[model samples]
Target chain A: MPEPEPIADFYAVVPAGGSGTRLWPVSRAASPKFLHDLTGSGRSLLQATVDRLVPLAGEDGVVLVTGAAHVDAAREQLGLADEALVAEPSPRDSMAAIGLAAAILQERHGDVVIGSFAADQVISGRDGFEQAVREAVVAARAGYVVTVGIAASRPSTAFGYVRSGAGLGVDGAPSALHAVGFTEKPDAATASAYLATGEYRWNAGMFVVRTSVLLDHLARLRPALHDGLRRIAASWDTGADARARVLADTWPGLEKIAIDHAIAEPVAAEGGVAVVPGVFGWDDVGDFNSLAALLPSVDGSGTKILGDTSAVIRVESAGSVLVPASGRTVAVLGLDDVVVVDTPDALLVTTRARAQQVKDIVAALRERGEDDLL
Target chain B: MPEPEPIADFYAVVPAGGSGTRLWPVSRAASPKFLHDLTGSGRSLLQATVDRLVPLAGEDGVVLVTGAAHVDAAREQLGLADEALVAEPSPRDSMAAIGLAAAILQERHGDVVIGSFAADQVISGRDGFEQAVREAVVAARAGYVVTVGIAASRPSTAFGYVRSGAGLGVDGAPSALHAVGFTEKPDAATASAYLATGEYRWNAGMFVVRTSVLLDHLARLRPALHDGLRRIAASWDTGADARARVLADTWPGLEKIAIDHAIAEPVAAEGGVAVVPGVFGWDDVGDFNSLAALLPSVDGSGTKILGDTSAVIRVESAGSVLVPASGRTVAVLGLDDVVVVDTPDALLVTTRARAQQVKDIVAALRERGEDDLL
Candidate 1:
């Protein structure tokens, strides 16, 4: 089969943020989840994210927006030009990161369709992912704020839900539907109910839209945030000194809100949002449990090993996830469905059921002033 | 309270052996359980063993029989004179270790009452322990092999039980009784039944007998083993050169059996064994669960820490045993009764219920040829 051609005038905006606190030692504030090879695929989540997008939006068409601290690391991984790598002075959450990238893409390459995908996510089924993105881009060009909602594989309470309304009836984007609204992570019963109705899909926070349309929506909904982003983008191409000055002056003061809250929710309510069904498998790898789900069982008994398989010696421990990142022997005996993450300086022991509470440990570490460990 | 005087001619024999397979990573063959302070006490189990014995058998009267590899470490910790530190060329089980200590004590200081105490046991209530030893010595002087039977706090199937027959009516040893026989680690129902009998006590393998009496019993019971111990003891006083030569030649060929099988059971059957009630708190710290019980709860909820408290950040985890021996942060979240042993080379994660099965992990490691970790 012939490879799909790169979409013309399309830009991939990778807003890399979130420390992935539940991942703890593996995903730190200095080097978050996006920078690590969570799937043991030899490529980091960020690099893999770019690898998937580069085919859809050519190498030069991809733009990365991440914290300034991670800029060098991101560049080292992707080898993206300085102009293409947009470094945020500090975290202003997803909205600002995505908004800034959208405005910059518009200012540099007028009115292009920019698809904002998170850098820290594990994805599989490359053809399906590319096909979904292609359809989403087509929907975006139709002047709708498009979201590629993942098929509800399970009633997961870990992610928000995007409810699909009527079909968009757009040409070339056959799977696209009008997004009704979005719901925050629901309780088990509510999530199950939503999954039962064939309308809800996991809102992966992927927004594909015309750069002009996103900026226009932002101007009407969040005028202050849009104006700040516009000001920064205008100075982006006026040399490194000017770009730094503008970012330093404006980045920190921008509104700190997720893109879902700022754009997806409000726009969906206005009937301007579209949901494209993503048949591909995807995960944010929220914790060790989610990470375990992404990794194949090294042993037949549902034991998942993220690092060197030989480093782990498991005995009667069914469904145990062991990350022997420290190159030391990790032995799990008679523990079923347990998670043991071993790093050089830190170790984590918990059950797959309690993996969501790992963030509590991070909070405790923070309260204990163990910032270095965090 | 007035301190008890050292019993005349009473020598304390500390047999420090056992790889403590169940407590692997923390207790390797090179560094066994006796060398570690599993109780969170400043002193090691070996040091604490000698400390408790010194009051009964003056500082100079304590003899530590350990593997040759651990001799330097034992000496460094105890500052024992060269004669008091009896280093075995190789392991030949509890019988060889204790019998050698007894035979050497007889060869050097004549027929003194020698008490055999395992170096890896944890004990509390020094007064109660000393009182038990005093009574046991009295019974030992009556020409019987006396054993200190610990007050069975629970129906533990982990330890052997000594069933008492009738009162010995010895002068000073008022509580001493004629031991009927010894039962190996029993089933749960059997242990519960034994505990209800009021005459049964947890046999902690503490034997107090006159060196001459023990040798006589060994001679009558196992003549070849008795002759071999006597031969090794004869050369023990000869210069280091001659001692090494004899040990190299005879140690390998000696019978490898536990003291329980060699003398305790046989002597008890022949009505030469006496049980002195030991009201002192004691534990073998056989596994992580037992070790957890020995350690004081760091949290109100049964969480036990063996190393630096600050290194651990536990959340919603009760009844967990954490040993952060590597000076690294160990975060345990939402795992109840879990055992996480973090060392520099190896890590063990299991549930308290499965702690006894940890030796299986060690065996698996040995199968994998991870000798360094062992």
Candidate 2:
């Protein structure tokens, strides 16, 4: 396909440190989000994210940013080349996780372009995604931070959006656009209106920018973060300082904010950001409910499960989800649109209408210290 | 109490030759109602019935009557003395089952009184039940078929009733009443009206009668049954009439009919039956639904289940009879008056409104040849 244009300059950096409570029970404290092979793709979302990035960044250039607590699982599962992972001393939110990666890359590769990616996501049409990221890189190298935008389908109030502007050139060079604006997750009416505009894209929390560009932008937009990151990088050579001193001091001190709010939007509002439409399908597997939706349909009618459920049921009971085996002869008589998740210590039954609340149920369970179920 | 009344005349003849599809999973093709130790009471209902008789029949007279397939379980669980046990050729219904027992007793014991009882019934207050049966016998010895009437507390539409007439005779015989009339299970309004009158007593399907009295009544009333019974009994000892075997040739040919319709009610309607009210709690453990009502409060205020219930749940889900421990763990949540029955191969989650139809469900399952569930 056009000799498959080489993906260079841009390195993909995944922030793999989220303790996603939204997928508790299934995704637990011991082995958190990035390690869950939730989509049954035979690879954790983190591994898949890395694989997806390899096409866009060339294998040797990809790096992962995760917490000290999770570094072991990350290394054991992702199997990357040497010096490819950065473990934070403690976990901070997106801003710090991203800032650490950018600062680390800026010192190592100078002004090389990097794409910030979240680990919990699914993407299809890699060829198209690579093309989109390469296009985004052009904008990033031309002195603008470009956040990949997933074209909006429905009025999902759960995600932030980028409002598109005019195209820049034929080669899409410097792929410039006077970005209209950025909106954090909106209310229903605002999202509905945004959806109608056709140019709004769900902010995938993914952004493309040269290492120097992100750090330089952070210096201007959040000076404290820029300073802290520089200090953290200087001590990396000692390696010992990386975990105990540098990260402990840096992660907790970095802005408790999203990258959009702390850097890109602030930079964009000042007329220095670009938006590139993501041409491939991408999903942030934010929770089990969403994760179930993305996995290969277990029933051929959309059922996904894991484990031995023979002890659970022996009949489908007319289309119920029995975890372990989606079609374990379980009888769900008089029940509809329900999920029967049978685990060793606990079982859960809730309709799809309330599936999102399972995490809340698990939260209450955790609060009671009934970790047996967890 | 009154020297514990000697626990004598305690012979129990459980007529279990009737196939009751009303109880399926437990009462199956090879094993029927009387064979089931449903309550884990250390004694099955039939076993309990025998124990009830033991106090009076003095152990040796505790007789068990079951169909051909169930003869082994009945005898094994009841531990009846040889010749005290009776096996039918097939399910000939209670009328013929009771007839075969009566005729066999007629030639062998001469003028002995007999207590004919259903095997699938739960009776508490054993001392009180023994007294009630003894009282019924006293009345029966004086030329009457004493049908024990359970003291009716609720206007339940699931049972037939006996109209208790004014008291007569002495011991005060206060318990004995002339059975003015018999009524089959009535509609709600009629049962409510019957309850208001206070003259109705639930038909317990238990009878105490002098062998002579029963024989005379059967000969006068259901001639066909009496003749069939005679032929069956004649076959019991004499292998002479090859085609007249009690457990072989006759049982399957005997008309399928309830003892109530075939004899008791017919005699009561003809003014030849008497009623004796029983204070002891007696329950026909007819179905899992009935088990809920009869078993000691399954819970202080929620659902109760027996057997393997991993398959059954009664959420809020209260008042359900889940049988998961019959093999599985049955958990009920957020439901009220639900019946979750978990079996090895079958599970039933039904609402209280449809509790009566559980038999229908079992029937449909049988018709579908879902034998595993059955």
Candidate 3:
């Protein structure tokens, strides 16, 4: 089927950040998870995210917001025009990132609807993703903060959940529902119970909102942060010097808050948030174990290789995740559910069950002042 | 304690062979285990073996017999004189390696008692080892093939077992006993049963016997191999060209038999074999798990590092063996009893329980034409 026509009056804003400490050695401070091709898809996660959004938002309507240090890399990978990229002078959390994008897009083209998708996430079922975004755009145009709630595939405690109340009864967004509440990562039992209730969906941190609506919500909920982002966005397109001046002046002072707490939670409570069912498969690709789930098994033993298969030699080893990124041969013997991530400067060996604890290793390295490895 | 005087007419024949496939990536065919410091003792196993014997055999009495390709490396590490090193034209197993050394020593010194020790075994308790060798030398002078049998520390199935029988009653060799028989690596149940019997000891492949007695046994049991070694030994001292000519002509055709099958087992049946109890701590360092036992715990968690400890970072990982020989930082998280052998060109990740299966990985790599990794 041909690609769906670009959504009218809609812009896609991709906020690429997070050090992804748990995926260390592969995901590091300088290059993080979004810059690597975690899925062996040839395209980096940031590039894949832009690729997914460009057709929906139109080539010119897609905007990228990333840390200043990563601007060159993200631009080189995505090949986005300079004006379409927004580089934050410093990390001020998701609020400043997405808000700055929404404000800048409003400054460039009137108050258009902007969808905020994290560049580090993985999503499949492109048609389903497009349909959800289309419906989310309609809900956003109807003056409600819209979040695409992923169909909870598992009772995972890795992500927060969004609770749908009643159908929004919007003309174009048939699956849109009134978002009643948002909850942080819940306990295992609570997540299972939420799954049983059929109303909870994984909050993928994806928000589609009209520029005016998000700015109004942010102004009411976090005035200082809203003012700082607006000031930065106002000069973003004026000139490189002016943009740099405003960013350096305002970005550092912006409140460090995730978008969830800044707007989604309060707005949902005030009956101004809508949840569109995202039937597409989605994952944050949090750790090696989660990465194993995203990768296809390379052999009958369920071994997954993210790099050169020829570089890995497994004997009686099953359910292993091997990342032979160092251009060296890796030999695994009689181990099951093992994670071996080999890089040129560092190597990580752990088990699938212990993948999340990789962050502890990174923390210990930091504590020991091995920042070069981190 | 003062060092004991050199034994009278005793020569040390160190057969430095075996690719140590079970310890691959570190123990390659080119370098092998004997050339590696698996115990982190700052000396290669071959060097330590020679160090242990230099005092007992006198500097000129110690001879190193290894493959032609490894001669230079062994000589570089050992600094042995050209006359003290025997380089085989090709691998012909233990019989050729040890017999060649015995014949050469006898041809030079006239029927001297020669002690054959593997270059790859690790031994502690220097005094006990010295005592055992001294007693074995006496037993060897009394016309019996003497083997040092290590006291069974555990019911390990990795090595063969030597069953001790009646005492030899040789003066000055009180610990020497008539060897009843030898058993290859047994099943767990048989190994446990062998350990229960007070008579069984781990066979460490150490043989002490008069060169005349060993050559005579070879003549009686396998005259062709004996004649071939005698011819090689005859020309070995004539000149470098003659020695190379004889070795190239005779060495390749020699029988490829381990000493146990060629002499030890059959000689025991004829009541000519004796075993001197070795009270020293010993291990072949068969695999990473066995290597772990040789290394002192680097942390309270019982983690063992065989190379630069600073290159390894462990978190919640207990009882793991790490060989960070690549000069790369190896981070291990939440894995117990895991073996991570990191090298510049190859890596091995396995568990202590499956350490023996590492050879299987090497075999698989070889099967896949990845001989460079092997």
TM-score of each: 0.96, 0.72, 0.98
lDDT of 1 by residue, A1-374 (tens): 88778999999999988899988889999889999999989999999999999999997989999988999999999999988988888889999999998898888889999998999888899989999999999999999999999998999999999999888999999889999999999999999999899999999989999999999999999999999999999999998899889888988889999889999889889999999999989999999899888898786899888999999888888998889999888988888998889999999998899988888988998898988988
Error of 1 at B22 (Å): 1.2
Off by over 4 Å in 1: none
**C-alpha positional error of residue A168 in candidate 3 after TM-score superposition, expressed in Å:** 1.5
Write the number of the candidate with greater TM-score, choosing between 1 and 3.
3
The reply for model 3, stretches above 4 Å from the true place, is none
**Rank order by DockQ, top first?**
3, 1, 2
Task: Choose 2 or 3, whichever is better by TM-score.
Answer: 3
List DockQ, one per candidate, in order. 0.85, 0.16, 0.89
Error of 2 at B46 (Å): 6.3
What number of clashing residue pairs does each candidate have, in the order they appear?
A: 0, 47, 0
- In candidate 1, the residue pairs with backbone N, CA or C atoms under 3 Å apart (3 or more residues apart, or in different chains) clash, namely none
Give lDDT tens digits, candidate 2, residues A1-374.
55554466667889886666666545666678778777666888888888878766776878888877788888888788647878776666777778777877777777788888888888888877877787888888777888888877679876888987887452555444556679888999999999887878888888888888788778887899789878887776566745467666666767677787888777877877788887778777665556665755445444455454332322223344445422222334444445555433344455555555656665656666756545
Docking level for model 1: high
* Docking model 2 quality class: incorrect
The model with the greatest lDDT is: 3
lDDT of 3 by residue, B1-374 (tens): 87679999999999998999989889999989999999989999999999999889999989998888999999889899999888877888999889988888888889899999999999999999999999999999999999999999888888899999999999999989999999999988999999898899999999999999999999999899999999999998999899888877887788999999999999999999999999999999999999988999886999999999999998888999999999999999888899999999999998899988888888888888876676
Q: How much is B42 displaced in model 2, in angstroms?
A: 8.7
